[model samples]
Target: MAGDLYPDHGVTGTENRQYNREQRAGKHEADAALYKSHQCEQTPHPGSWRRHDQRTQGPLVAGYGIYTQGQEILLTFSFCSSLVSGYVITYFPLRGRSETIRLILSDQGAKWTEEEVQFTDWFTANCEHKKQAVFGQLPKFKDGDFVLYQSNSILRYLGRKYGIAGGSNQESALIDMVNDGVEDLRMKLVRVLFYEPEKGTEKYEADLPDQFSAFERILSQNSNGTRFVVGDQISYADYNLLDILHVHLALFPACLASFPLLTAFSDRISSRPKLMEYLKSEARKNRPIVPKK
Candidate 1:
């Protein structure tokens, strides 16, 4: 399995650490502000979760500030990634790429650590070497000395390791198809949105109809009257779609309002007990630091 899989978003351990710290501080600040504003609460629901200013930590440490320095996997989350549904869905399974790995990791009860990193800085710093890596870019996974980049490959590794990839080869292949299909749709949507912003709202407005229509069609076809994207059980695909949907709803309300099924789906997924908890916790812990316009 390892031989067939490639790491899509591999970066040096040092770089990953730096990126994670920044992300953590940003998320923490955002949560803190959200809590203060009464917008939300923290997840895992504990009285001990206190909100604080990240800047107070003083002059931002370079690397490995909070993460346990041991065998662990780093998942980078960023505002840029969260801004677009396509990118969120393509990489972060909860938002889009495929939540298979996330689900497997959660199900296996793996106690892996998570780290958020800014998408822009990470990409800019490593853009020159993207083609050299197997997975192309991030949402990379590092276990011990080995690093796996591609989101799908990471999911498969986690599934197989945790005995959740599937009961048979046919099932595993199906999972891959669903995951790849979501990726394809998300990429197309992103291209339409980002390719020509200079054309103004007219162009942006014109493109959304078709892209959103396609998303609705795909969701309708894949729906079997179940909340999960594929099969009887929840997989990575569901999480990927959910993450993307949340971002879309948050950033592009106009686009989301046009599609009722997508809107409902997004709401349903986000309200899941675990995710809701996470969101609440995230909101309370990370105070939003508004940047100057």
Candidate 2:
């Protein structure tokens, strides 16, 4: 999977660390301000879950009540505003597996920053950052002090954190099913792109129709394809599926001609306000689906 997006390249571990340190340094001040304003220390809530400020490595809790003998407990609580400070994605410059995660953040208008990993940095034998990856892969994610690897896990984590997974257990399972299906197809695409770019492209295109029909069928089950794939509200699955559709659309402009429902689904998702803006931004531009060979 790492080879799918990250091909062999070379660089010094020290250089990669220096680059990340600089990136983190630039955002430290602004992130600190956001933490101060939104963290639990400033805004407490009833039965608030504990959160940590990664910058300070301090605990932030709320909703505890003071008890007095033979008196009612005075619970101090209030509605807490959005306390999620920011997110960081460390990946190579290509869209690859990380694009879906980016789409979710953009659609939600969440604060986030990217720590671009040069190809050389990922493949470097002595890369300190590489050693930190539990799975020895790219696209590691960070939310405050918590760190996670694997693109699918990161997507689900964001989905749950942002309440986009679904409303019910059944719906959430359906959403996961959709995302897993998308991942299966994505792996096939990766094979063609990285393993056999010469002759594999033609064969993959030939089978593309049958592959896409599965998603088209999924959409047909919901509002004749007008609604989201799993539930009424868009889930992480939508983002993941839409990203793959975009990539296929680029590969075969006429790919979705036979699947009107999918075409509409892609159109509708791309038209979302924040997502639309992100799709056109410089940050999204020039980043190829895969890194250049």
| Overall lDDT per candidate, in order of appearance | 0.47, 0.74
Candidate 2, residue 102: Cα displacement in angstroms equals 0.5
**Model 1 regions lying over 4 Å from their true place:** 1-111, 114-136, 159-171, 192-196, 200-205, 218-224, 283-293
RMSD of each: 15.9, 13.4
Please give, for residues 51-154, the per-residue lDDT of candidate 2 as tens digits: 22211111122232221222212221222224444478899889998999889888876657899989887787988779999988979898766899999999
TM-score, candidate number 2: 0.73
Q: Name the regions of candidate 2 deviating beyond 4 angstroms.
A: 1-84
Q: Write the per-residue lDDT of candidate 1 for residues 1-293, one digit (tens) a residue.
A: 22222133233455444454435654555444433353221233222212211210111111112222221112222111111111121232123333334434433333244444444544675554354456566565665446677776776665554444455687677666766766765665555555754654456556767756755665676563334555555555565666555545555667777777777777776676655555566532242221112
